[model samples]
Target: MSYPSLAPYIQKRPWLMRWMRPLSEWYFDNAGYRKLGLRADDLIPEEDEMVQLALKRLSPKEAYDRVFRMRRAFQDYPYLSPLVKEVMAEQTEREDLESMVINKRKAAGEKKAH
Candidate 1:
């Protein structure tokens, strides 16, 4: 079967999907390491689970608040570890938007005034 076919199968079989998390993790850990990879490290769990884990270890509201706070701070965390410096370099580089829009508009205004 192809990947597209598996989507509906997994959706229709929630129990099967739940059971396959470990297998999926294993597949991601090896061949798919960069993306579907980092199985153990990428386990963000879910909102409710984070809340429950937080409540169990801390307080109910505290856990909820902490989860959201962490999410806002580190949601891009998965890519940051490897891509932080690279992303910073890109952000500082020449702006495509500036070249296309600002320069074009300036030329157009000059032509109109002439």
Candidate 2:
């Protein structure tokens, strides 16, 4: 499931971005993850299947970097989110295609019965 985010909305409006920039930075700075040297994405749990799949899809170097950052408590950045989104999108597409196929089969069966 896709979560709603204001990022794109704020980015499209220069004034909003300007206003939110400092506040966002302040929040992030004080969010305690920075103190721990962890990125925002690092806080995301690995228990989710989507996240697990995303991790599996990462390049060897990227996977190593993720482990290194976690072990070293490095600063935060969103590295895995895009891959997670892609995985979710692919799943949704597959589901939709499967449903379409099922519906088509049902329609064909009904036509033959008539």
Candidate 3:
């Protein structure tokens, strides 16, 4: 799963958020994605199966818009970030579970062989 972020903690403190807002804005602006007509989420790699599944789940209009943005950015997308994050988290969890199961099965098989 995606590591826990400090973002929520920082955001919950009004003073910290206020202090960080300008710096965050500056960072975002300078990141250059906007110049490429891409949102921060658009930079996420789509090679993951989770990402592909999330793309498939997008609404038709949203999917069309995402494609258009990607084409524009190539010359890139709101629900996208949350959806991507959720998928990534799920994928990680699944991987972890699969590894645990495999390890258990391997250990059991080794015991049987011995």
TM-score of 3: 0.53
Question: Who is ahead in TM-score, 1 or 3?
Answer: 3
lDDT of 3 by residue, 1-114 (tens): 254778999989999999999998899889876776677667667888788898899999988888888897665334368999999999999989888843334554465644
lDDT (CA) for every model shown? Answer: 0.58, 0.82, 0.79
TM-score of each: 0.27, 0.51, 0.53
lDDT of 1 by residue, 1-114 (tens): 112447578868989989887887787666543442233323445456554564577657765665566565454446555698887767666565456654444664465655
Better of 2 and 3 by lDDT: 2
Task: Please write out the lDDT profile of model 2 over residues 1-114, one tens digit for every residue.
Answer: 556889999999999999999999999998766776677777777988899999899999988877887987644555678999999999999989888843334554465644
Enumerate clash totals for all models, in the order shown. Answer: 0, 2, 2
Specify the highest-lDDT model's number. 2
TM-score of decoy 1: 0.27
Model 3 spans with C-alpha error above 4 angstroms:
1-4, 76-114
